[model samples]
Target: MLTEVNLAFNNLQGSIPSSIGHCQNLLAMSLSHNNLSGPIPPQAFELPSLSIFLDLKSNYLTGGLPLTVEKLKNLGAFRVSRNRLSGLLPNNLGSCVRLEALFLEGNLFEGPIPSSLSSLRGLVALDVSDNNLSGEVPEFLVSFGALKYLNLSFNDFEGVIPSEGVFKNKSATFVEGNNNLCGGIPELHLSRCNSKTSSDTSLKLKVAIIVVILGVTLVFSCLLILWFRKKKEQPTTTCAENSILQLSYQSILRATDGFSIQNLLGSGSFGSVYKGILEESGAIIAVKVLNLLNRGASRSFLAECEALRNIRHRNLVKVLTAISGVDYRGNDFKALVYEFMEYGSLEEWLHQSINRNESGIMRNLSFFQRVNVAIDVAYALEYLHHHCETTIIHCDLKPSNILLDQEMVGHISDFGLAKILSSDRLNYSTNQSSSIGLRGTIGYAPPEYAMGSELSTKGDVYSYGILLLEIFTGKRPTDNMFKEGLSIHNFVEAALPEQVIEITDPILLQERARQGTFTEFTLNDKHLQHLNSIFEIGLTCSAESPTERMDMSDVVSKLCSIRVKLLHPTRVYRERQALYIAQSAGIQ
Candidate 1:
C-alpha cells in the first residue's frame, strides 16, 4: 500500500538494504538528508515500481552512479546530489528516458561528461555543478527538446561555450565557477576564444599554397601540350541540364530481375517503383512502372515526366529519363527511371518501428534532422511555386511522396497531379474540372481541394503543413485519434506552446538521445519560443481558408530565420517569427 517513503530530514543510519527492491508497490523512495553511507544498493535500482523519484540526496553515498541506474526506466527524478559518488557517470543513464530532474551536483564524479547523456531527451534540469566533469560544455545541451535548468558551475569544463540554444541565455543556465570556461553569448561576459579554428590549419594552408604554385607551372605546360594534341570541341551552354539517357525496355528488364517483386520498392495508385541498377553506369535507379490499366495512370506518367523535365532543384527528385515501349509480354509497358534514394521516404522514417538504411542497421531520424528535412521541403516548394519558369503546384504532397537521399535531405517527388500555372493558363477553362477528383491524397489533401475549390499553391502549402506536423508529432493527419471534430490542426492548436510536448512524436524525444548535438531541453524561454513559432507556422499554413495561409516566400524566409536562430542565436529570431505570425494571423 506504500506510495512514498519520506524518511528525509531524519537521522537514519547504515546503508539502504538491497532487499528494498522487493517493495513492488513503492512509488517514491526518499532517504535524502539521512546518514546513509556505502554504495547504493543495486537492488534498490532494480525495483520496477519506483517511478516518481529516488531521492538519496544530502547523504554520504559512495561509489560511482550504479550501472543499474538504467533499471529505473520509469524514474521521474533522480537526486543523489551532495554525495560522494565517485568515478565516471554511467553511459546508460541515458536509457532512463523518463528522468526529468537529475541532480548529481556536489559529487566526486570525474572524467569527461559521458557522450551518452545526449540520449536523455526528456531531461528538464541537470546539475553536475561542483564536480570534476571536464571537456567543452557539451554543444548537444542546446539540442535537447525539453531541458530547462542546467547547473555546470564549479566544474573543470573548458573550451568555448557555444552561443546557440539554451546557451544563448546565460542567465537561465548556471556555468559559473568553472574558471576555465570562456566565450559564450555576449551577455555572459566571458572572454572570447583565441582560436576559433585550429592554428594547424593556417600553417597547412601556407604549405599547400607553395606546393600549388610549383605544381601549377608544370601543369600549365602539360595542359598547353595536351590542348594542341586534343581535338577542338564545340562549346556547350550551361543554361539548362539535359535529362539522363533513356534506356530500352530490355535494358530495364535486365537492370531489374525481370520485374521481380524483390526489386520492388513501393507501389501506388499510379504504378509501382522498383529499385534497379544501370548495367552500363553501375548507378542505382528507381524505375517507376506505369500501370496502364489504372485510369488516368498514363496521363499521370506523362505529367510526372513533363513536370520533372521542366524544373530541377537539388531538393526536388532528379529525373534520369523516361522509357516508353512494350515490356517482355509486349502488353504496353511505360516507366520513368530516376535516381534511387538509399534512405527511401520520410513516411517510413516517421511511421516505421525501425528504419534501416541500405546497410540494414536500424536508424532513427533526430529532431534537427526532421527540421532540416522540413527546410529542404520548404525550399523545394518555394522554388516550385515561384522560382520555376511556370508555377508548378505539386498536387500530391505527402510524406510517402517526399523521398530522402543518403544524407537525410528531403526531395519532393511525385508530380503526377502537378499543375503548371503558365501565363496563358492563368484563367482556367473547363478542362481543369477533370483535376477536381485528383487534387492529392485523402488525408493530406486540403479541405479546399475536397470542396472542389481550384487547386492552388496554397493547397501544396496545406499538405506541407500537415506533413510538418506529422514529422514532429508522429501522427498522421488522418490518425484514428482524430474524430468528433478533431484534426491534426486543432490537436496541435489546442496544445499551443505549453502542451506541444505532450503531443510531439515520442520518437523525437528518444531520437534526441542518439543525436550528437547536446540535448538542449525546451524548459528555457528560448526553446519554448522557438517551438511556439514552429507550431504556429504549422497552424497558419494549414488554415481552412487558403488565402489566409502563408505563401511559400514567407514560409521560406521565416523557416530560414528559425534555422538561423538555431545556428546563430545572437538575435531573437523566434520572437521575430512569432511577431510575423501574429501579424499574419491578425492577432491583436
Candidate 2:
C-alpha cells in the first residue's frame, strides 16, 4: 500500500483515503469496481507525475469534479464516469493538452460546455452524454480534427447547430441525442433552419414561388382529370383495423409518457426510439417516431406503415400499431409501434458506453451465449433470404439492427431498405442501374453491390460475414484506423504470421488473464491462438468474392461447433485455436 496499489472489481466499500496522496512514485492507480464515496481528493487531481491511466469509475463518488484537475499536466487518460457527480466541468480543463481521452458522461453535470475545451488539440475522444448540460453547442470543438469520436448527447442543447465547416463534414453518428438540436448535419435530416433566418426564408420563398407557378399551369388539367376520376374513386375517410386512427397521437403520447428522455432507448436517421406501454393491452412496446419533414427522409416515413403492415415474420421486429394524425399546431405526424426488446440491440450491448466498465459486458457473454446470438441472427437472415413468400434482402445488417430480448435471443429490426424479390424475377433489384447504386450503409454492403452487379442471396452472405467480423472482434465497420489499413483483417493476418500480440481488444486480454483461461501457455501464446481462430472466421466471411464466402447455414454450423467444444473443454477446440494461429503465421 505504501509504494503502489491496484484494487479493482472486489466490491470493496467506502471512501478513498486522502493518504493516497503520499504515493509519490505511483505509476498507475486503479480503484474501480468498488463501493467508494466522497469527492476525489484535491491532491490526486493535482498530481504532476501522474502520467499514465487514472481510472475511478463504477463507484458511489459524488459532488463536483475537483477544480484542481487542470494541474495534472501529463495525465494521458482520465475517466470518472458512472458516478453521482454534479456541477459544470472545470473551465481550466484545457490546460492538460497532453490528454488523449476524456470520459465524463453518466453524471449529473449541468451548465454549458465550456468553449475553452477547444484548446485540446490532441484530444482523440470526448464523451459528455447523459448529463443535464444546456445552451448552444460550441462549434469550435470540432476544429480538433484529430477527434475520431464525439458524443454530447442527452443534454438540453437548443438552437440551430452550426452547419458550416467541420459540422458539415461529420457523420450522422457525430450528433444524434440532442433533442432540441436541429439542422447543421445533413445526414440526420433534422429540420432546416428556422424560417426567421435570412438564408432559410430566401430558400423557402424561391421553392414556394416555383410551386405556385407549377400549380397554376396544371390547374385546368387537374380539374378535368378530377371530374373524370370522381366517378370511379372512393374517399379513404375510414382508418384501417390496425390503425391507431384519430387516437394515434394520444396513444403514442400515453405509451411513451410524452416522449420523456429516459424513455429514449436509441436514435437514428429513421427517428428516435422510445420504450412505452400500450395502454389498451398493457403491453410494453418500442415506438419509432420518424422525422418526415426533412428533405429526402419523407419517403421512409410515408412508406414505413405500408412496409411493416405488409411484411410478416417471426424474427422481424413486430409492428403492433401505427398512428397518423395532425398535431395541435397542424403539423402532420406518424409513428410506428414495435414489440419492446428488453435487452436492447446487440450493438448497444457491445459498444454503448452506458452501464459499462473496463471489464465490459461483452466479456461476460459465455461461449454458448455468444454462439446463440450469432445463430439467432443467422436463422433470421436465413428466413429473410429464402423462407419468405417473396425473398426480402435486408440491405443494412449492422449490430444496431440486431435486437435482443429479455432472454437474450436475437431479432432483426429496421426494414426501411428491404428489397422484395418477385418469384418470376431472377435479379433482386428493380433499378436499371443495378444494385450498386442502391447500396445500404458502407462496410456491410457487398463487393458486388459496389460493382453494380445483379443482386443475389450471396450479397447478403457477404454482409453477414462482415457482421460476423464485428461480432467476433467487437469492432465497428466504419472505424477510422481501418482507413490507414489497420483493420481486423490486416491486423489478424499480420498477427498470425508473426505470432504478435497486437490484434486483440484489451478487454479480452484482461478477461482471459483474470479467469486464467490461458494457463496452458504464456499469456501472449494463448491470446494469439484464441484470437487467430476468431479472426479467421471474420476473414473467411469477408472474402472479396461472394462465392468464396460461406452461407449463413455453414457459418452457423462452424460457430456452434466451436462454441460447443470451447464450453465443454474439448481438447480438439484448443488444438484448433493453436493450429489456426500456426497456419496464419505459415509456421505449421
lDDT of 1 at 108: 74
Top TM-score hit: 1
Q: Write the per-residue lDDT of candidate 1 for residues 344-431, one digit (tens) a residue.
A: 8887788765466567756677766877888889978987886566677777789888899876879988734333333233343324
In model 1, which range of ten residues has the least summed lDDT? 231-240
Q: How many steric clashes between backbone atoms does each model show?
A: 14, 1
TM-score of each: 0.53, 0.47
Residue 107 miss distance in model 2 (angstroms): 49
Q: Which stretches of candidate 2 lie over 4 Å from their true place?
A: 1-247, 295-314, 352-364, 415-429, 432-438, 451-456, 497-502, 509-534, 568-588
Q: Model 2, range 312-388, lDDT digits (tens) per residue?
A: 44456767676555554556666667778877777766653642544664424433455567767876776666544
Error of 1 at 37 (Å): 69
Error of 1 at 437 (Å): 4.9
